[model samples]
Target: MTVSVAHGTARLSAVAGATAGDAYVRAREALTAAGLSEDDIVQVVEYVTDPAAGCGEARPAGVTVSTVAVEGLPEPGATVAVEVTAYRGGGERIATGSGVVTVADEIVYVPGILPADLSAGFREQYRSCLEVAGELLKAAGLGLDALVQTTDYTATATRAEYPHCGRPRRELLGGTGADGRPVHPGAAGILVDRPLTEGAMVSLDAIASRRPLRTVNPGWRRYETLTYKPGIAAGNTLFMSGFGALEPATQRAIFDGDLLAQAEYTYAAIAAVLREARLAGNAVVRLVEYVTPAGIADYDKVAEIRAKYFGGPVALTSVVCSALLRPEFLIEVVPTAVFP
Candidate 1:
């Protein structure tokens, strides 16, 4: 087990099979070990067996649902999983990029996100996230053009299944300009996955700055914005929104039903986003990963991925739980890129 803490965030990488209740207690313990408090911890991420499935009558005790996605992983059974990431201090210093987007000015969550009924998934989930991102930009008086980076999440999107999901995403955020003009492409990163749910294909989180778009990338293969966020904040510091393990082209999950593959795609996407943002792999200074119980056994693999890409000494946290959008998505990644 390795733990690192910095910038008001705590990262714990451990290999232990624990139930939901146990993972909750361990989260508190990890916080205490880092000299942090529960109140200071804004979110709780965990990887535990599905309380409703594997545990069944033997479900752990005292696990209150602050946030939960019960069916967000591989088949519910004895699966070893690795997880990493977190947002500390209620994510105060790290302002919501969506909060600053001028165009996406509101946060609306449609409870019944039916993948089959994409209107709800797109309008309420996909479009709503962009709306929030746009709102964040709008609050800062910057149009959607000011945005340089973005990350998306979905619970159960596959290549065959994502086209239907991407339809609304493309229409709403595909190429619309800040002034309501049509652009060639839109958004920075689109990550989706498969979890246990019906028609819950999208749940996105993003990070951007009120700063100006200064850096530009010559490599124009990317369909979306070359920059991840607008402006260079206090030097080239890149704060990323939460991302997951979906194949970029189809917008479907790459891992199928594997946490390891999920983590790999996630790290790969982070690396791609960093490079696209003109930052190095090591620029990943902070990470917050969401995991499910099915992935708890392979905790080492998550650490390995971080160590491989981010190197040693970056702050990370692994939370055991479900994704808001899909049930089979075992991992979702949130990263911060900082340059020297």
Candidate 2:
């Protein structure tokens, strides 16, 4: 079996203007309560409505921090949500720049990548972002081809223009795959409440490895033209993009406005990807469930469906986004796994 990866998350509300520090403390305490230490954390994503509230220097030095600016957290009055990904093999230690990376017993997490030129538009900003990512990974003896997954945070105001990112993305990521097509990384892109930096249009989070990255498709040709892949596998891990219960060939959503039905179809689709990766449900290490406002009513029942597919405890994080890719897509499930 693959070595276990530990995950922890917590959300907390503080007095209106001062939420970041308080929430950060509560999150650390929660992880500690669950038996995780700061050293075990390889990746940390702080979802906050307020960008000014980050822990800054107070954040764990060895962790790669991804800041997520959301409209609001799921918890009422909660200003921040802290999510952590940790490895439990007990050899996690910092090897290079403190905030840039963390090597663990089983994985390497190189998180947030944002352009220093916040004044740059989407294209320039992303170009800068990719440059830094390449530098970081290259220094680690890897390349964009080593990336297994990516998360995108784009300004809500520029959401319509975000697709333009495809041009640059196509140019940078794909190393040399079939037909000269790039073996793109699995990804999830969402609209943030505001810009990441002062005027930055986009920022990103990624996971990579020194091992050769490979695409894991469920025999679907729909992604042949797009820059995103259904899943990417590197080392012993598989990273999947957010998937809803949609007909892969026709691109029609299978279940609309029904969380349970959508959840069923979504998991089945996930099972297909797992099969493509030569893995079982028990290989899953973490999951992030993004739900739309309409899906909240049926959220509780999702657990029952999860238990059916997941053989052991799976680390989880859930967020209620302002919206999903489609009105009918009540929920989108993102799964990451380590092979057994």
Candidate 3:
């Protein structure tokens, strides 16, 4: 489907396959079918359950791609889920752009970091990733202050490690130079069984824009530890924080073990946030689903519930990960939508 934001228009599509390699080819073909050439494509996000899945090789030259490893997918035995987002107009490339690439003045891709030179440790690895992210933003002629949303993938992250995770990000991206203020971006963290990079504890990616941004938070839910808004809207695009099956008032997970129920509740939460932003589910153009090992067995059930929320075709990427922020949460859903 087509999504029109303030800077440009994006066309999104999804391709699936029995194997990662095949899915990569199909994804390219799907992008071609959607009328996007190699250079026209902006970003690709691949979800895989297997660490060996070679998603990087599938990416076209000059396009930024991020592959996330998860616990399971809705398609049984499927190794890769590919989602493509291509922009039709309005963006520029900086002279020294390196790992950070900008698309349509809205999205930025920070390539996953595999710091082979650095000693293996969570703090070191995470710090290195943030360093790279900062370099990327600088290369794109932007800074940490321009970021409106971010996503982090980690091998093993716990509530205790949450602050440690934020420490590096805040140090790098949370301050306004010469203004004495804090830059708060909408953020989401995913705990994967394994990351695409070996010995890497965490990888960071983000979206930034020059357009004005406003945080969107429903009055019902509250966060005790994490430092992220419920959602953020920039121009005509909305970036939602990851949603789980937690009760709005209680902040407790509902349907602890039931995948379908959890999926429904997650969608309900997403819808509520969308409503607060003056948007709806059908406006969504991108969806990312993270499922645990137990939840992977019921992937189809989760898909069935997803179909009930989105009306048109959406670029969907599903992955099976080891666990979530909370043990009881079987699934986490992240969505992006465009408003008129």
Candidate 2 accuracy as TM-score: 0.84
| Per-residue lDDT over 1-340 for candidate 3, one digit per residue giving the tens place of the 0 to 100 score | 2332323555554566677677878866766675656666667677776768576565666566666776666665677777766666325544233443755755655554444334557766777776666677777667776677778877554445655766766576553412333335777777876767656667676777766666676775364234566777777788877888878677777798899888898898888888998887788877877788788777776667787888777767666777777779888888888787
Better of 1 and 2 by lDDT: 2
Q: Report, for every candidate in turn, its global Cα lDDT versus the true structure.
A: 0.45, 0.71, 0.68
Tens digit of lDDT per residue, candidate 1, span 130-161?
55555555444545444444444443334344
CA deviation > 4 Å runs, candidate 1: 1-17, 45-125, 132-161, 164-199, 207-220, 224-236, 240-280, 287-308, 315-335
Off by over 4 Å in 2: 1-18, 30-36, 88-98, 176-182
Which residue pairs does candidate 3 place in steric collision?
A: 70-320, 70-321, 71-320, 71-321, 72-320
Write down the RMSD of all candidates, one decimal each. Answer: 8.7, 4.5, 3.5
Indicate the residue-level lDDT of 181 in model 3.
31
- Candidate order, TM-score descending: 3, 2, 1
Candidate 3 local Cα displacement, residue 234, angstroms: 0.8
Question: On TM-score, who's better, 1 or 2?
Answer: 2
- Give the lDDT of residue 266 in candidate 1: 77
Tens-digit lDDT string for candidate 2 (105-191)? 435577677786887788888778877777777656677776767777775577677778888888887765433446888888765
